[model samples]
Target: MSTTISTVALGDDIAALPRARPAPPARRRPPLKLAALWPRVRGWLLAWPVPLAVLALWQLAASYQWIPAQILPAPLTVAATFVDLFNTGELQSNTLISLQRVLFGFLTGAVLGLALGVAMGLSPLVKDYLYPTFKAFAQVPSLGWLPLLMMVVGIDEALKIILIAKSTFVPITLNTYKGLQGVPSSYIEVAKVYGFNRWQMLRRVVLPAAFPPIWNGVRYGLTHSWLALVGVELLASSEGLGFLIVYGRQLYQLDVVLAAVVVVGAVGYALDKILALIEARLLRWRRDAF
Candidate 1:
């Protein structure tokens, strides 16, 4: 009878205990649309508002003669000038010439800069000998070299190319050096423990770590080269986009000058966009690249 009473008490205690509750159902997300996949496209479209507003204000100013037409030129007039230049193929020829010059200069400078940067980065002795001189030379602007380049290379294609190359070289070398310097000592130690040869170490460890800054330098170098090319052309050449601006000015055609300026800005923007696309594709592995 006591055992029965104890069993009854145990059963009552078990019934008094709280039971486990079931989990709520998982949320079901909506399927993504095609447009939803490309956030960059939306970002790019959003960027047009500022430019469009500026353009609208410019047109308004032109319509009201807020600025003298002789100096500012109406947007419509500039458009007409662009159409004329395009039909004549003059714009195309000049643009092509400028692009070719920049490409040649950029390639040469990038190659040489990479070599010099790697040398200085890897060798303390080379850095000690060359870095100070390079920094000093780099303090001088691209146009500052024009006079010396004119004396040495003359007012020819060679002079323009050399100046552009110099503009490109400085940023690339500096960035490459900085990138190499920032590589983790721990990474190098690990590489050493793994018995990596010099080439293996550079290929497997250094290049990956240094690529981001190096790529940034290359982008900046390209921009510098373009600007330097225009400056060189303005000072010396008779057949490039800069000369088109000078020629328009000489003829008192503000519209022509504005048209040329527009082309210059458009081309530069296009170059940057191209470089950005290339960077994005190549560095997709990076967390914050581009």
Candidate 2:
């Protein structure tokens, strides 16, 4: 009986010995509180106040005849004209032409600007010889070149393209040169310590460091090119969005003019937003106050 009692005691002690407990089922993380994003939503909503006020004022003026109907058509009239032009494909065609001009001009100008800029940045002699001349040439507005360009290139697509390209070239060249020059000395020293060759140093150190300012230059170049294209079209072209504006005015149809103006503004805004989005994505490595 004592042995049995001892055996039973031994069994109880063994059972009481700590055994690994299965981990309490992992506590699940709570889902993100989407409701907490209300502030951001409110902020975006608040941004519309200015545009809304402008629209309201515009409508009130149209209703009260504060401005002559011929000079400033009702917003509704402009909206209707926009719809008509869109449905007829008139707006699309003109916009497409303008976009094509910009694309060709911008690409050509960017490539040339980048080459010259890199050369100038890399060689002091090139900068000394070319930089001053470029500055002087750039000081003249794109329109100022239009008359001379027309005389040489004629009032054709080539004229518009060249002017747009010139507009794009100046800003990009300056920015690229400045950006490359602005790269930190420490980065160059580090590259040298790593025994980087010229190509490796430029690719691994210079390009990344210079990209932000170069991108800014590209943005400005595009904006300037668009403006230049429109101005050229207004001055010389028979077709394009700018021509549409001129045609509207000549016909005394303010609605058409306003519609074209609105489209230009919208397209410009859209392009800027697109570039901004791309810039943000590419520069995710950058830390900033915003």
**Model 2, stretches more than 4 Å misplaced?**
1-43, 287-290
lDDT of 2 by residue, 65-184 (tens): 999999888889999999999999999999999999999999989999999988898899999999999999889998998778878989988998898999999999999999999999
TM-scores for every candidate against the unseen true structure: 0.84, 0.86
Model 1, 6-92: lDDT tens digits are 999999999999988899899989898878878978888999999999889989999999999898888889999999999999999
Clashing residue pairs in candidate 2 (N, C-alpha, C atoms within 3 angstroms): none
> How many clashes (backbone N, Cα, C below 3 Å) per candidate?
0, 0
Give the Cα lDDT of each candidate: 0.92, 0.93
Rate residue 268 of model 1 by lDDT: 90
Residue 288 in model 2: lDDT: 57
Choose the strongest candidate by TM-score.
2
Off by over 4 Å in 1: 1-42, 287-290
Clashing pairs in 1: none
Q: Report lDDT (Cα) of residue 158, candidate 1.
A: 94
